[model samples]
Target: MTYAPMAVMQPTAHNRAAETPLPPHAQITYMERTSSELPVTEFFRIERPSFDPATGQARFFYRLNDLSFTETLQLPMGADAAMAVSPAFAKLLGLTGLVLGVSYFKLRAPFAIEAPEIALTDAERAFVIDVYENGLGEFYARNDLARFGKLSLVAPTDPVARQPALDLPDRTLLPIGGGKDSLVSVDLLTHTGVDFTPFAVNPKGPILTSVAAIGTAPLYVTRTLDPDMIRLGKEPGYYNGHVPSTAINSMIAALCALLYGYSQIVLSNERSASEGNVVFDGRETNHQYSKSLGFELLIADTLANATGGALKYFSLLRPYSEARIASLFTQSTKFDAVFSSCNRNFRLTGNDGPLWCGECPKCHFVFLIFAPFMKKERLLAIFGKNLLDEPKNEHSFRELAGLTGQKPWECVGEILEAAACFYTLTRHADWHEDAVVRAVKADLFAQYGEEKLQLAMAECLTDSRDHHIPPALAAKVAAYAV
Candidate 1:
């Protein structure tokens, strides 16, 4: 279906104050509740949700063995109008549980299943193994690679079942992450006049404001983690690190699309996500694998067969590099203040803290990416400080530029792209004077050289052919390509 371009709407005026302060590190407790003996899955089921329109709660319940997880999607409006409470919608919710169940199971590193599809087919088994092994690559590398390597899947005892695709609406469901990339997608999707809903998981603070800035009321869901997991992390043998959250959110978005009748589920992942930070256990370990084209294709195929060819899922910005994405983000100046790419802002526990923790690799890289597109004053205003001006942040920037260590396992661009950004900064008179930039100037020139730096910059500006975007969606995003 073709969507026409619509003029952008004015944002609703509101007081934008900083949230109550919380310790940046204090918020997230890496909670992994693993047993020496894997937690046996008695059965997995999604109960019928209890929706209270008056109070505005859409609660989803899931039970995996003895553990129970409840996810409440706090809607902006009443749930009564979202859709009728039907079995079809209930099944979609169930499927969402099935997808999220994988992550939950990984927490304990379960070994056996008791019921409700006790085993999976070779294909089904392979899909689960891929998502788990690759998605949980970071977790495995950090915690216990020996134990994680020993993990295995239980093959299906019966044939795999596929659900017929439900008849759904033509509108698209766009997952918003309150970052520059998603904002760039918002601009493109808006310009195309696509019937799209900006949706978010655990939306608060910046995300809500960003949706408002686009003049659209967001469809948001709050995800609450099991408190027990946090307590378990404190225990001595429990493993804890990062989970492939993008994979979890993608499934949730797909469920919402099916439940609400949207035909397409859109994301903002870029080409740079495909690059691996390091290799672990003879496998390429990428922190952003779930957001990569490979995972996109895997999930797309898996969901198509599972859902009987219903919804379409793809990243709108997959073809572009992070450098190209930053370039596109500059076209829309409204999000400069509200959107934040810092991972520190959205922790799993407690209230969120500052948007930018200037000490982290994310802070250093985003600063470098924006330096080429935005002026010095504008960039400083967004980040609250000049990252390059701080000698303290030099180590982090060095990691990003490949001047010293491997790419810090953060959702940063490729090393060469970081080099390209640094090279671009050298050409910018205001940026070259920064303390960190001045320090790294010689090393960058020696490693990448002037000629190679320009080539990397050119490569970054060009789009990649690797993507799973549908033809129509490709045509829409193509207009913004640098």
Candidate 2:
């Protein structure tokens, strides 16, 4: 692949050679460009060693250079495992460069960082700068900080927080997803008397149906993936793995918020988003780092600064856990039939396939968590099968129960929630005869025992209360026995 050359160099070298080396398997090369131009930066190359089958070890390196900085990431991999990153992820990195350019303009910083010879159009640069400044302004105000420390250069003074008794208009932007989270959010916001406008992108059948069931004013955005980009994947050499969905979704959410003219953009993101990613070296990195409080705050700050305090962005369900959100939906019969947490149906290319690929981690975790609260038959109807009945799902259930492996990095709450439900179900006489439940009891349940399980449940509940579960939901949960 072709790449632009470096623009200029102001080298300030600092060494930390004592730091522990990263694993051999994964490497990431990050290049930031504040240049006012399209295609301002490029990721030139990535290299990974062939794994040794006998010894089970591999190494990888990533390199990138722009006028300002040349950096490399080195990683080692085990024979049985590999580190994967998608080309979509590289696009996000590109977008991040654009965002940084916007940020630099807003901050009016002395240094102009750009890819060598690449320049942005004046209009595009202004738009990015405006958005970043608007976002940062609100962030400082909301946090009650006296001044923008490092962020001051990019953000204007926040006027919104200066007003002591500001009346925020009761306008809501409905976050649409092909999952249960949005369904629950729609229900809660509707019942709470907020005037809402439903917004969706890349429409699909199940999501459209769910939105219709909510009976709200719906707005749809059409999105078409660039055909040339898709064609690139068909070539003999293409990189694909996982792009941080949070980054893409945040951009989409911001765009939607702008078009809809809504003050508050309500997202259905849950507490589990704060859970760290499982690193290749058995260490944990926050997988939802993009979805976590840090990203949310940064985006919100950037919008406030860029817009001059005109917009507000936040996850309304940020304080709620997946389990608590599930419980909230369970209480509302209106959503019982409409909601779905299955990931299979949400994919862009897999509609003709099974709606619930029951073997996936998400399906197994969701089914297990909801089992104790919803009636057996009713829950099965929602998922189209008794997921706990299958031996394959049973294995997944054990994995989630913290039996065979570390918790899956997607969401921390899944493991804790499943553990609580498994604890509750094993003690109940009615659920005792279920094959998966029995298997759970024999294989993993017996090891934890009742006291340990109950303690684990209490810890989960306490942790949820401390971080994830919203106050209103916490009150409701306090009244309900697990």
Candidate 3:
């Protein structure tokens, strides 16, 4: 029934605003409760941060139920021409602050099923569904698939004041994740002469190396989760799992677009992300749910509502398949040495020793995707070793090729797409002799027959029209599509 004061992490020159009290953490407990007994008094708030130009830092705070969290973002000194920022942009940042809280809120899910959706409008509620239900669909299905179907969310009934539109510039804000798809996006934007600034959260070795490969500086934004969430995850009652990271990152990009006066926010998600890994309780659980077209539309519509249709957010590579993205990435050998899709290498602090661990699903899939596009020697040189050439990779490729087992719970292309890539390579002189490829090809041909392999290859070459790419950018993106 009480409130926890927002914790400020950094000292800044900007003055603090009055703190509005909200529900405390003790108000919600998980012990011995049925679905109907779930607490409804839970509240989440995004407190306005004070930005100190002297330190070039902005300190923001948020609360979920009773747990308080603080995140600080330090801007580069003298990056912009003006020191003054508009209030509308501050509100946009607050919206992003709310998103920051929601991402961490997943650590408390199922236990605290009810959120302050009453704080959101009808459109905002729909956006929240995409962010929570769909975005966290993988998290729920992984932890408790059965109970997930019974969960329902409530929306805010209170009216919100709409703000006037901002006079945004033509520049685009592109978010980079130190991968082939983002690097390909950078190439497309540069080729079209579109003004853009590469944006990232918690810049590390792989991200820095990838951005440096293209010869440009990036606008780095940092997000720090409360250490208590990690501690709480170890507790008996608190739930923990993956959150819709791309959804969270998109919100960060949206705020950056507003703060830097950019009208467009560009992402690098591919069309293959739309497919689900498995269906459970009448819902599809996709690891890349946040990157799907549905989430993209929700984000676009939500941003329009929040910012008066002045800001735009969508993926530049949404039309291209993973195979097509791999082909386009092969166009520029400049990034081959630095680009990595291995999720293992990416961390909050630093990349693991090797860029390619060559063990995980991502490493195996990246190897398969690049096999048909780049030469065997060049691909091996980039990965430090040929993944498909390794005899130990047969099982991994089996999952990728769908010759055996379910698709691994990783951000990979669908089973048929992987099969298509592997099948296509069997006909190519460069890859047919590799050990893993030979094993996968032999197994797939034996199980599904040669005709199915042929069909899989044909499907890989086709592009999906299910995207929200703007009319102006569609021509430019299509030029690079395979």
lDDT of 2 by residue, 273-340 (tens): 65432332122244455555545665665555434455566666665556656666677666566555
What is each predicted model's overall lDDT from 0 to 1? 0.68, 0.48, 0.69
> Residue 472's C-alpha lDDT in candidate 1?
73
Q: List where candidate 2 sits over 4 angstroms from the true fold.
A: 1-170, 280-283, 409-412, 442-449, 459-482
Model 2 scores a C-alpha lDDT of 0.48
What TM-score does structure 2 among the candidates reach? 0.62
Provide the TM-score for each candidate, comma-separated. Answer: 0.82, 0.62, 0.84
Which residue pairs overlap in candidate 3's backbone?
A: 25-66, 117-155, 117-156, 118-156
For all candidates, what are the clash counts?
A: 3, 40, 4
Q: Candidate 3's residue-wise lDDT over 373-414, tens digit each? A: 898889989888878788998988887766655567788875
Can you write out model 1's per-residue Cα lDDT over 295-348, one digit (the tens) per residue? Answer: 888777766655567778888888777888888887767987788877766776
The residue ranges of model 3 lying beyond 4 angstroms of the native Cα positions read 1-66, 75-91, 110-119, 145-163, 480-482
lDDT of 1 at 326: 86
